[model samples]
Target: MTRFAVVAMMAVALVGCGGDGGDQSQEAAPEADAAPAPGTVTIVEPADGAELDAGPVIFVMETEGVEIVSAGNMDPGTGHHHLIVDADVDWTLPIPNDPGVHYHMGLAQTEFTVEDLTPGEHRIIAVVADGVHIPLDPPVADTITVVVR
Candidate 1:
């Protein structure tokens, strides 16, 4: 082939060999906007290891991919919040309704206030439980420690 013809053929081959002309930006968009996985829960306030003055402690909780409903709803993918304070949890059994230890938010409330903490360090855990106050399988919870002065 002539010099010009050979160069033209090489140019066409290079262009054709390039990647599939799909938009890379579109391919990455979904991952950036993806929703949280099912049963994801987190504590939004009073960051871990926080130190605060002794008094009423307010807790703010958040959940993703799970619906917060009143206790006894018995609906799939739905439950309420429970605040476990400075106590060991029995994941296989129903959370007890004990004061100053296991606080159940049966009304689907996301915020809670604890007014009975003594001055010291305390372990706080936010747990999501089913309508019957039983924790979900695989256990959706967030634990943090805070010191009260």
Candidate 2:
């Protein structure tokens, strides 16, 4: 009789679950079809901990598993670059996106030249972003601090 009561309760619960029950089970997709990881960006020129001459500033960078579209969405395996100048100057810290505090490279990843930096302590940070010019939730890569003299 206890078993019968238990079965009756289950039937009533199911009936109360009206419509989809909100507990749909799903199968996992194959790992081979999983989304690829975002690219890794590293400044190849003006090696980290280097100083710059008094002139235009250029940034050389490389991004893997991402495209370097100059103006558009960062298609699959593609991403773009953004530059932040004198930004509180720290990578261990999140990149600043303040209107005038940051410089965006948009979709370009090639060399960047900034000719108006005054002679003083300045920061040159390069960040990688997905297409549509949006930085990754946590940012893929950030090269911070390149003092200009």
Candidate 3:
């Protein structure tokens, strides 16, 4: 196996997830530049500023240059993705895995579903973080809001 493969395997064992089942990383390097282009994150579904009735909030995400991996590995050009429901993020710290609120895609999954949110206006922010869960330098993030009825 390659060095990164080994490291990734180890990270999976060492930092699987917090008790809430969201992979949480609090000890990663500050940033990622291993990818070709400066990364960008966008919501491909539910168009920003959209309105909907009560149901599942399915999000399709778009990412480039940055490879999605476990939050436990600090591979450059590689990082994981997460959805910040109802608010913006503190780029100064590791993104929290607060379950439905701050959802972390530990395995680097590109899509998500938030179900049964109470009626209100909700802001969803997509953030890409390095192996240790720290936001990229200058932070690659995009925000969209949906009003639920």
Q: By TM-score, who's the top model here?
A: 1
lDDT of 2 by residue, 39-93 (tens): 5676777777778788877777666545576646746555567777765444344
Error of 1 at 59 (Å): 0.3
TM-score of 3: 0.71
In order, what lDDT does every prediction score?
A: 0.83, 0.62, 0.77
Which ten residues in a row are the worst by lDDT in model 2?
20-29
Runs off by more than 4 Å, candidate 3: 1-37
Cα displacement (Å) at residue 84, model 1: 0.5
Best by lDDT: 1
Rank the candidate models, highest lDDT first: 1, 3, 2
Tens-place lDDT digits, model 3, residues 46-77: 89988988998888777655667777888777
Clashing pairs in 3: 34-76, 34-77, 35-77, 73-131
User: How many residue pairs clash per model?
Assistant: 0, 7, 4
Error of 2 at 113 (Å): 0.5
Give candidate 2 misplaced runs (Cα > 4 Å).
Answer: 1-37, 88-100, 107-109
lDDT of 3 at 35: 39
Residue 134 miss distance in model 3 (angstroms)? 1.1
